[model samples]
Target: MPRLIWPLLAALLLGACASKPEESPERTEAAQYREAQSAMDANNYLTAIDRLKELEARFPYGRYAEQAQLDLIYAHFRSQEYPETVVAAQRFMRSYPAHPSLDYALYMRGLANFYMERSFFDSFMTTDKSARDLTSATDAFEDFERLVTRFPDSDYAPDARTRMVFIRNEMARHELHVARYYARRGAYIAAINRAQYVVQHYQRTPLVPEALAVMTAGYERLDQPELAAKSRRVLQENYPDSEYLDDDGQVDLAWWPREGKGLMSLLTFDLL
Candidate 1:
């Protein structure tokens, strides 16, 4: 009887233990931050983004708000939600202009716009981006410039400067692309204007020689022989070995910008 009673008591204790609900881990700002960080470490950017947003919402004035906001921007970027990254970055900058991570926000904002210029398909292809609409590229350049200008000593300033060069060149190439298109269509005045913009705004780029060539062609087509001669002379002097210049140092009248119609063109009817 005693043995049976002991077994029953043990069973009852086991049942009681099983019936008690397990305590949930306390949710705190730090705990949420750690969860988000873990998600980020795992490259689960979507989950990280959700956790970060929740953290920010639940503890707007919490000590981790600023860091969480910055992390949110990065997570959005990694998740390929470029527009969200930009918006979050912009919001952070507005909210905390004096924050030490302002440079980081500026850098990420620039990166977001940079990626926004290229669609997901464009990222995988080797197609030329200079022929596409460069509004986002222009915005990105401005953002990087702002970062470099405001925080010259920042860790991101060097990279920003480097990206600035690439953006400037892309913009110049875009202008040259427009110029060549106009020249091909016999819009000489418009062609010369676009080429001139490249020369004025995008100095030190390889596209300058091509811009000069376009200007020369446009001026010749417009019957402005003197202007054409001036442009040709500048091209000959600055770029003696320019591809647009013949062995005789004269501008090649038949040269046109090479256009690429890649997979993107097939899918988008060349709109991109």
Candidate 2:
């Protein structure tokens, strides 16, 4: 009787175990993706990243893999880990060049740079400890330009155009600032060249007014009074309300001045 009972119990346990349904691979993948989504919703970005990575590894060709990759990139960005965010975004672009989300990925890549750029004043003071990020910003702008040019109808195009404007203005401002530094130090030749670059290359930029003011000041410092007067006249004519001019029709101190003693005298003189 004991042997018969034991055999029956073993058979019953085996039947119960065998009757349990096996989870389909699709179901497992769905479960993982759901977990990742839940983590993300909770703002547990690190956990979500780990879960999504696992999902991709286990189901590379699954329905959720692409979304997992996209979310991973976003997670890195949300974590303020820009380098990782860039890496993930670039990977997405390379892997799925024609994906509908490619535009978004490209835009994010550029936005990362925009956030990384130093303020105009910081760069001006030469106190920009974040100068290294400018390289990233330039690369991001290039990516954004590519997207706008290649996918003009993309939803991101307008934003990309706006960002391009910002980047161009920033670059123009940077050049103008360097020109101002040179002029202040009596490096009139260098200042004039930089100012000319702004005028010629970035004529339509917001910084044009400032660039023209710098050119007027630079020409004055270089003893090119004729050129200086022409530049000032143009500035006053084109930008009548420009704050670049003082009440006496003179360039502000922020602009270069003509009346200082020659560079040699200023360097050699000892004021008592």
Q: What's the number of clashes in each of the models?
A: 0, 0
Model 1: what TM-score? 0.85
1-272: candidate 1 lDDT, tens digit per residue: 99899999999999999999999987999999999999999999999999999999899999999999999999999998999999999999999989999999999999999989786687668878878999998899999999989999999999999999999999898888787777655567898999999989887988999899988877777789999999999999899999999888878856543244468656865455
lDDT, model 2? 0.80
Clashing pairs in 2: none
lDDT of each: 0.88, 0.80
Name the Cα RMSD for model 1: 6.3
**What TM-score against the true fold does each predicted structure earn?**
0.85, 0.77
Off by over 4 Å in 2: 1-27, 118-133, 255-272
